[model samples]
Target: MIARWFRLAAVAVASLALLARPAAAQQILRDAETEAFMADMSAPLVQAAGMEPRNVQVLVINDPDINAFVAGGQYVWVHSGLIAAADNMNQVQGVVAHELGHIEGGHVIRYGEGMKEATGITLLSLVLGAAAIAAGGAEAGMGILGMGQQAAMGKFLAFSRAQESSADLAGARYLSKAGVSGKGSLEFFKKLQNQEYRLAIPQDDSYGRTHPLSGERIQVLREVYTVDPAWDKPVDPKLEARFERIKAKLVGFVSEPAQTLLKYPESDRSIPAHYARAYAWHKSAYPDKALAEVDALLAAAPHDPYFLELKGQVLLESGKPADAIPPLREAVQLTNQPLIATLLGHALIATENDANFAEAEKVLRNAIARDRENPFAWYQLGVVYEHRGDLPRAALATAERYSMMGQDQMALRSADAAMQGLKPGTVDYLRAQDIAMVSRAAVEQKRKKK
Candidate 1:
C-alpha cells in the first residue's frame, strides 16, 4: 500500500518545463518496496553523474501526470503516472538519468540568468513603448510592445530548449558510462512522440515551446544512442519484474475498483495480477476478497515480505489488529523497513492492550531512529506515550508530528506545552525546544511571504 505523506513544499519545475505551474503542497507516496526499488535503479546513474548515491533521492509524487523532474537539489521527483506509463524499469532509469543530467548541469540554479535576460528585454520594450506613446504614436507603441514581448518569449524558450538538449546528451553519456542500454531512452521518447501525434501537437513549431519537440529530440538522440556500446544490452530481468509489480500496484491503488478488476481479472492469477486485485478488493471494502488475493500471493511466494506486509495491512485496516500482528511482526523482522515497523506499532497500539504498549513504544522508537521523516510513526509513538501516562513526551511527540506536517502553529503550541512539563536540558525537552524555534522561524517566514 502507498503510505501518503503530505509535505508543504514548492512543486518542482525544472524538467518537463511545459508542465510548470505555481508552487503548491503535494502528496508524497512512500512505500518501502517501491522506494528501495527506485534507490537501486538510480544508484548507477547517480554514480556516473559523479555524485554520492546516498545524497541523491528518487521520490515519488502522488500526481497522475506522466512527468519527472529535478527541482534544484539532489532529488528526482517522479509522478505516479510516469511509473504507470513506463513499460519497463529501464524506461524509469532513463528518466532518472535525464533528471540527474539536469542536476549535474545546474540548470535550475542557472535559470535566473535566462530570466534576467528576458526581463531586460521586457523592460527595454516598456521604456521604448512609453516614449512612443508620449510622442503621440500609439499604434507604433503597441507594435513595439508586442514585438518586445515576442522577443522576450523567444529568448526564454530558446534558453529552455538548449538546457533540455544539453540534459538529453548528458543523460546519454551517463547511460553509456553506467553500462546501461539507451534503447529504453529512445523508446520512451518514441512514446512521447506518439502522444504528441495523438494530441495534434505541431512538431515543426519548436521555437515557441519550452521544450524541444519530441520528434526533434528523438532525431538528435538517435545518433548518440545507436552508436553506444551498451545499446543492445538487455535490462535486468529481476528489476524489470519488480517494475511490473509496482506498476500494477500503482494502477490498482489509484484506479477505481471496477477498473482494476477489469484490468486484472480473476483469470489472471499471476503475482502482479494478484497484487493489483488485492488492492482493488481492499479499496472496494471487500476484505475477504482482498485477503483471498493476498493469500494467493502468499501461497506462491511464502517468504515474500511484501506479501506478508500486504496481509498485515489488509487485516489491520479491516479492524482485526490482533490477527494482523503476526504477519506484521514477521515482515518487520524480515525487512527492518520503518514504514512496516510503524504499521506494526500502530497495530500493537490499536489492540488497546496495556501489555502491548511497551513493545509498541520500543518498535516505534526504533523505527523513528531509522527514519524521522515519517509523521504517522510519530503520531503512533505519541499514542503509546499517552497510553502510558507520559504526558510530556506525548506532547513532544505531537510537536514532532505536527512539525513534519508543516503545521507550525500547532507544533509551536504542542512544543510549549511539552516544555512546560519536561525537565530542562533533557534530550526530549531540548528536542521540543528545537521544534519551537524552527516553528517560530517557519511561521515568521510564512507571515513575511503573505
Candidate 2:
C-alpha cells in the first residue's frame, strides 16, 4: 500500500509542519521500535565531541540504493541498502559522521538550498514535500522511499568540489570529537572512492555530485587515522552494537523479500543480521518461519523485550492470538511501547469478550497519550468509548480527530454531541481547546510559509 503514489498533500502537510519543529523520526518510518533503539544508542555520551544527538537526527530511508543524503538542518536520510551492506558499528558510524560533517559544516543549508533555488525548485519545496510524502509519509514513515520513484529524478542535487572536501575534513574531525575512531569514516569513504567506477553513474556524478570531495578528502582521512595522529578516538562498544542491529533490520525490511530472505541467515554467526531476517520474514507474512527464527533469538537472549514483542506479533499473524497475549503484555510492561499498545488492544478485542474491553481501552489510552495526533488511535479509542456507553467521550475523541484533520464542521457537530450535558470546565472542553490550538498552529505555519 505504501509503495504507491507521491502523496503531495501528505508531504505538503508534513513539510508545512516541519516549519514549526522536526516531527518524530518514526513519523517518516513505520517501524517505531527499531528507530527508538537507534535513537537511544546514538544518544550523546562523549562530551568532548561538542555534538548532541537530539539536535542531529539520523533517519533511515527505506531505499535499496546505496545512498544517503542530508536535507537542511540535522537530518541525514540513509538508504536502507547502505545500512545492510555496511557491516558492523564502525562502518555505520563512519557514514553517519560524514553526514554529521555535512550538518556541522552546513552543506545542506549552504549548498542544497543554493542549488534548489538555482534549479527553480523554490516552489519545488512544496512539490518535493509532496514527493517525500508520496514516497510513503516522509513525515512519519521511516523516511519511506523506494528506488521505484526515482522516476522524477532529474538530479535535484547540489554541492561543489570544495563543499565535499570541507564535509569530509569536518567528518573526520567529528569522528575524533565524538570519540569514535575516524577509522570507520576512512574505510567507508575509501570503498566509495574505490567503487566510484562500479556505480552506474558517471564519475562526475558520484557522491561527489551531491557532496563534492577531491583528492584532499582521502589524503587527509588516510593521515588522520595514522598511528599517533593528531586525534583519533575509539568507537563505543554499546553504540557499535546498536548501529549493526538497526542497519541490518532496516536492510531486511526494505530489500526485496525473497532476495532479503536468501541473504538473511537466521544464525549465531551474526545475531543482528539474523534478527533482521526474522523481522523481514514476519513482515512478508511467513509467521511460522518467523516464529522459529524469533524463538531461536529468544533462546539466545531471553531478556530482550523487543524479541518478546516480535513473538507476540508472529503468534497473532499465525492465528494464535490467544498465545500472543503473554509476551505482548510483557513487552508493554517493560517499555510502555506505543505500537504494541495498538496491537495488544486489537488482540484483546479478538480473544476476550466485552469484559476484556477495558484492556483495549488501556491500550488506546496509552497510544493517545504517546501521540495525540495519530488518528487511528483516536478512532479506536472512540470506538471503545461508544461500546462502553460513554457517549460523550466517544464524541469528544471523534470530534477532536475531525478538527485536527481540518473538517471543522464535522468537528463542531461531533463536539455538540460530545459536550451535551457537559460542564464548561470538564475534560471535553479542555480537549476541545487542545484540538483547536493544534489546528490553529498548523494553519498559522502554512500562512507564514506562504
Q: Could you give candidate 2's per-residue lDDT for residues 137-172 as a string of tens digits?
A: 676332222221221122332234455666666666
C-alpha lDDT of candidate 1 relative to the true structure = 0.86
lDDT of 2: 0.62
CA deviation > 4 Å runs, candidate 1: 1-24
* Predicted structure 2: clash tally: 15
Worst 10-residue stretch by lDDT in candidate 1? 1-10
Model 1 TM-score on a 0 to 1 scale: 0.93
User: Quick one: RMSD of model 2?
Assistant: 11.1
RMSD (Å) of each candidate, 1 decimal = 4.6, 11.1
Deviation in Å, model 2, residue 83 alpha carbon: 1.0
